[model samples]
Target: MITAIRRMFSSTIGKFLALAFVVLVGVAFALSDVTGNSTFGGIGGANVAKVGSEEIGLGELRDRVRLAYNQARQDQPTLTMAAFVESGGLDRVLDQLIEGMAFEQLATDMGLGVSKRLIDGRIADIPAFAGVSGSFDQTRFQSFLRENGLTEAQLRRDLRQQLLLEQLAGPIASMPRLATGMAQPYAALLLEQRRGQAAFIPASPFAPATDPGDAALQTHLSQNRGKFTIPERRVIQYALFDAASAPVPAVTDAEIARVYKDNASQFAASETRRFAQVIAPDQAAANALAAKVRGGTALAAAAQAAGLAPSMSGELTLSSYAATTSDAAAKTAFAAKRGDVIGPFQTGLGWVVARVEDITARPARSLADATPEIRAELAKNKANEAIVDYYNTIQDAVNSGASIEEIAADRKLALATTPPLLASGRAPGQPGYSLSPELAPLVSQAFQGAAEGEGQLATLVENEKFAIYAVKNIIAAAPPPFAQIRPDLLADWRLAQGQKIARDKARAIAKAVEGGQSLGAAVAAAGPNIGSVQTIGGRRGELGQDGQPVPPEVALLFSMAQNSVKTLEIPGNRGWLVIALADVQRPDPKSIEPARVAAIAQPLAPAFGNELVEQLAAEAKRRIGVTINKKLVDQLRQELTGNAPVAE
Candidate 1:
């Protein structure tokens, strides 16, 4: 009971909204998340909703809904748009869109301004723009913007709204403290239990006596086509090339000599010195310490006498040592001869005194001595330049309307063709087949449409490897022939017919109970196929104890009014359940253990905070004034499912 409530109330609105934004920008490359042509064939573009003076366009709403669906498909691969919409996915997207629009307007009305520097910091923090070194990379950032079809201004506007939302709602939803008295009632509610009587109406016993005609079965199959429909698959022909394939440029000796000459300072004679140093709390103390060292008191002993320890500065060059300490400190330490005491100049650590211990001098290297190092550097630079030139040549070939096969032939590159693959990069009906990592992008682009003859160029592993690909064939998603699936279709038709009969019977039983007939009598009247009435009683929170979700019929008992009966369909069309709530038990607030109450209260605090933020959003909406065009929203949904043409 405690576990369930804690999980339910732990998250704040701030984290929730932040996660929503992350989904939008993080998967910028998943442009094909919404499959099929993006062209809105006929429907005209118009505002779906208006929040304050800002209008929410149909295109924006469509894009957001597609994004939400894509995120959901990560968990449920076969989830359909119809099912997603039925499950309130569209409404959730609409609500989030309306809330964002309201908040942005509210922030503007309040004169809140987000600085460019703050927005830059946020953009830099996004992992999508991070490079191999895990820092912001300008090239990667720009590439993402181009691929996602977003302008810098649009991105900044989104980030600004997000920042404004955080400023407005973050404080209200910050970690809160819930009073023990307030939490006591909630904790006591966990102890409350419900008792009910449940009767199962097995659908199999109610199955049709004979198989339906072909016409009827076909109608059922057509209505439920998504169940039998295969996903679209495509075959791609492609050629790949990597940095290894690029020609290596010859490095002349003159180039190596030039590099060696340019870095003369690096090969010059130099010395690395090590020092023993002590830091004092102040300049006067340091001066006294240095005086002691100069008077034949060893630096370590003098520092120890003053209750400080002497530390060693590792071997460092003049410039390197200056980085660690101050410039003046490094200069003074190096200027002193070996075994000489140097004084009392200010450093970052404190007022310091130091003694030089050792100095190792390195002789200048001749051209022959530096040849190996300089040669390696020049070769690496030449190789990189050659690779860049190679890539540019391939890109230019693609831009000049060369086919994948033609380009491969011209460049002497090897070509490979892929087996038919789904958008998910898996071969349809071939369970054991594994997709090559390099071919995944080829498959994705093929389905999106690689132009005829010319094909498409895609980077397989960023700058290191690339592929030019074109779609060879495409198999669109559709139901298999009716004859091929007749047996399964017949079984489905029978079960569906059985479910309809079971539903009618369950409803009659529920009606009988409402008409003052005893639940057992109602069950008996429904005939022997009905399961015997059984008493069911338990705490509501214990319904999901076996790792599976609570049965809907059982869960409904907790929410139903006492002495009321309800009928619910069993999952998977197995049967129906007639449930009657017989009794309700409420525990006293004083009965809960204080420790448990505290545990429950801790999570409940977030709920209170979330509510405050929700209220803030509601207040924003009220101030801003929102208007929705229901007709356009309905048309947009139709367009999404291809039932209606989309407007430009």
Candidate 2:
């Protein structure tokens, strides 16, 4: 119970949100003396919650707490420790607490046991555990464990169980099968030697005729009413609480000097190095070159004698490796240390030799000088405590059936309008408004929510400051009147005519070229007004071509025959193209298999996670059942820092 509470309460929100679950631990945690460092069921600290003889340890609890803390920091950077504590970082802390104990308990009950060998193998697989020599480094492994507050043995045992629990959930998906016969056209892999002639008669050159009537216009409107409805949109004025706006207290001069002295090494410029390299075929050959380097021969002279490229002595930063940077041939350059004759490091290009001439360290920033800025930053973070409350009030007003204007007035928020929206998800009258970053998604969600008038207010969301929206008015979609749409219809009709005329001309050119007329001759015969023909290379997707990937209809266009002459007639858009297959290159089977496998695995990947969640939930219910402690959850929700009121 104590472990669960600790895990639940860790958050960045101010108090009342977390509701201080810690105040309710019941003194049982204090009296119990076992700290769960080694137990397989342990969390981070002393076991406050126990299932049978198994206890959730302080170490595991701490790990989960740290992970949650880091995540909170990332998700809500302005969160101050005080706000976090108040917002009931404690409740989130508690959620994690309950979740961890529950999952651990469920895994135990299922008789799932992880093996030591598997744990060892997994640890060995980590790149961090490898030494500079590229072998498993026991010293580094031990150091890493110590720093993270874990004993290697304890970590191994827990990791084993965790992996086993995860694996037991099983794979939840299968590969996407390429539909039968879909690859038939693509399999042709045509490489045609084409000598073709074509002319592009720009339809824009001629004025299109227009004679319209209400009857025709109404027909057009009836067919395309999707173009005129007003979108359901809301605008809200939000408060911003920024950390940069906060004032940091000044640091004392003495403190600043002390901080600088303490971190003097940081102020030093890094070492500058000079080295010459000898590219050898393998590590053994590289090692031989290192011996030569050490045996009093100049690195460049030695390389020349060894029948390798004699790279002249050059200066480099300690971190720079030419082989690892721009020059692949100089990759063996990993040998530079203070006054040390280093290397014959093996790289893609071969072996290298280096000598360090000097170490220049960088300057350090003192804590005293930075304290005021830090404190000001802290103050701004604290100031943000009220923003989430604002989102909450706005949401509360909407949930209680307030009108858009009423909600906006109550919260003193803005009510913004969008460009005239269409039923097909477009803003017909505004530039880029049809596909704007924020407005588009916002409009779509507003329509998807609970029916028109009793506006659905979204969670207080913000790119920076907290934001919430109340649907002002939901427009029920209907076709527009024909009188208002005739002009558009005529414009579209004329373009279609022009494309037909242009295509006929292009076909004649293709046929003439086949009959031995020069491309220039065919184009001249088609019309003097024809524009230059353009050739491009592209693959098709739902968006017509990869570059135009958008609508499902367009993607179909890309799948058509490589060189087949096709006319694409989109409503309001007319285009024609003559495809001449230049080449079709199939990817190498072995090289592309891995990429395909990964692509297939991506969507299937999340199923395992979902399965695990469900499995644990089921197991947990079967074992101990759920008791929401609704009061606690509610209290925690009330105090959430980043988004308190919205959750309500």
TM-scores, one per candidate: 0.72, 0.33
lDDT of 1 by residue, 101-131 (tens): 7887787888887899999999889876764
Please give the distance, in angstroms, between residue 191's alpha carbon in candidate 2 and its true position after superposition. Answer: 8.1
What are the runs in model 1 whose C-alpha is more than 4 Å off?
1-24, 27-43, 67-71, 115-156, 175-182, 189-206, 235-237, 251-410, 415-420, 430-433, 441-463, 470-476, 501-567, 577-598, 642-648
Q: What is the C-alpha lDDT of each candidate?
A: 0.75, 0.45
Clashes of each: 2, 70
What would the per-residue lDDT of candidate 2 be over residues 1-648, giving only the tens digit for each residue? 122333333321111112111211211111111255532222234343453345544334333433343334333423333345565555555544454445555666778777677777867766545533345767556544443344555555445544644544433212234332333222222211222222345554442576556666556544443343232233322222222323334445565556556656554444445554456777776677668778887666776676777553456653565535334323333343554566655455655555544555434445655556555655455445344344445545655666766665554556565544443345544556544344433443343333345544332233233334444444433333445655666775566567666667667766765566655666677766565654444332112334643542233223445334433333333433333333334443334344444443454434444544555545664575544435434433343322344321
Error of 2 at 644 (Å): 45
Best by TM-score: 1
- Which residue pairs in candidate 1 have backbone atoms (N, alpha carbon, C) closer than 3 angstroms, thus clashing? 43-646, 43-647
Model 2 bad stretches (over 4 Å): 1-198, 201-386, 389-450, 455-464, 476-486, 500-648
